[model samples]
Target: MKFYKRTETRKINIGGVIIGGGAPVAIQSMTNTNSRDWKATVRQIKQLEETGCEIVRISLPDMGSACNLGKIKKNIKIPLVADVHFDYRIALEAIKQGADKLRINPGNIGSKDKISILAKEAKKAHIPIRIGVNAGSLKKVHNFSDNFLRAKVLSSAAMEHVKILEKHSFQDIVVSLKASNIDITVKAYKIFASKRNYPLHLGITEAGSIFSGTIKSAAGLGIILYDGIGDTIRISLTANPVEEVKTAYSLLQSMELRNSGIEIVSCPTCSRCEVDLIKIVAEVEKKTSAIKNLKRLPKPVKVALMGCIINGPGEAKDADFGIAGGKNTGILFKNGRLIGNVNVDKWVEKIISMIKDYCR
Candidate 1:
């Protein structure tokens, strides 16, 4: 039921997780914990992994943090990506410590000879390198007056780095072209994909707080992904990294591109609404958050929670299961048929029970 044709690209494995080459778009998040504190980093990574994060990146600011890569990798189930900058030596150290992939900006990672050295070492380890180019970090294109021109400049910068790695006979690469602005980010990715078949990682860099960041990322990423351009994605929110993973899966699910976890289709209330819809929806979400590995379900268990009967019956019938509220009672339905009514107080408990049964 995939609606869009994916752009074929070279497949690259991050540890055992694959991206591109018609593989499912991988979800990634970065740990905000200090890498040198290997214990804390491991704890955060484990949390992300349990929340369905397939790959995790951690900052390697110095040799101290680079030395902890093995410790972090050993404790986590997902692939570990090392974020290194300025020094090529840190990149080499990260490789030595068994980083599944390396993220670097060649523009600031020293000279061509140093990059060649790092490239050779990474080749030896059979690990991929991500050339992450952020608009804020780009040395060129200070004026972003015209988004198309900015996108061209951004794509050029990423190509320059790609060529450097290619020159060294290193082709295991992933590329990310990111900007805070949706227009520039979408345009750059479209431009880059048309030029190379390398796997592209998508994101809106420095996207703000959870509320706004989710909207901005969805709007921007939706455009690029719907066009069938990106291979992997991260919704970079200023909030906890776990939220980032949740947001990523939700976005993919909305497009019917992925099926994992609970897909709640609820309505915004109005005067016609008789029940406390806001409170009910919040309670449902909070309770369901404890349901781990819903991804194991054959598909997302579609759940609809509506505040009024006007459109409630239709929406409830449309979902795998749902509750259409009226007064203090709700009409529960499953697979388009009535399942009898339940008190408002029992909605959360009933939905949780039905979901577990549905999954089983």
Candidate 2:
């Protein structure tokens, strides 16, 4: 398959992970837990790390939260980014407290002196700053009558904020133009890519709950990533933040941009389906996910769980391990060839065993 020609942008290191300049697109998620609640936030961040989140952001709504950054940083393995707004002092405190990166709109920080201070402090800490410009927060995002025009407006706003940092000789920067509307968000990124060589942080701002947000993020981020425009991605969802990281990786996998983890391609059951395909698939996914973030596997093992005999065998044949149902029994297969039949009750255990063997 032909891959999208990725745009070459300046690479910025967020902690140890690199973004842009043709590097692998990093996955990011924000902690929803109260930042001041050190234990809970650290717990959530650890969970995100297990799920393959490379960069994590936490809100610095007050000085108390900002002050706790050092403690949180000591507990987390991946890069910790602080999300601050309106106040440059909190941004300054976040840097001194050991934030690996900062997410702040330079334009909203009051004055050029404040922005200069933030830039100098962040550079001294060897941390990059992300100029997050959301369409909802743009000065004229809604003032424009046309949707497409609003996208241009969004892009323009981000560039203007970017210039403030550039004026301070701060080039260690990443930018994002996010909107809940996928089309507008995509357009804005495209426009910005044409004008700048800064690494981009991609996401649909406030992308709804798990169910709907996944679909929207996949569509919008998929399109933008396909254009080879994004350097890092965060699948924003109102649900548990872990879902965000999982969904980001899934999107990258779907685009064949990533080959990490076990990718189970199962069929949606039809009238011909007689077995409990949903339950079996869910169990297999849950059990096998433990090996996902590890480097133990030589490669991702494709497991197909088909509901019926006709399409099941054909589809399962392609997977490293798969099963097709027939009456009360299902035919187990290895690499497209049938091995044997098993009771439906044993399906989950059998798949789990195959996975363990493969990982070994």
Identify the leading candidate in terms of lDDT: 1
lDDT of 2 by residue, 1-360 (tens): 538788899989888999988888899999999999998999999999998889999999999999999999999899999999888899999988889999987447667678778888887888899988887666687888787899988888878878878988889989998989988999999999999999999999888999999999998988998888889999999999999988888888778766556888799999898999999899887887776533345556788888987889896677997888878789888888888998899998988888777877
RMSD list, candidates in order:
1.2, 1.6
lDDT of 1 by residue, 28-55 (tens): 9999999999999999999998889999
TM-scores for the candidates: 0.97, 0.96
> Residue 350 deviation, candidate 1, in Å?
0.9
- Model 2 TM-score (2 dp): 0.96
**Where does model 1 exceed 4 Å of error?**
none
Positional deviation of 41 in candidate 2, in angstroms? 1.0
Whole-structure CA lDDT of model 1: 0.91
List lDDT for all candidates, in order.
Answer: 0.91, 0.87
What's the CA RMSD of model 1 in angstroms? 1.2
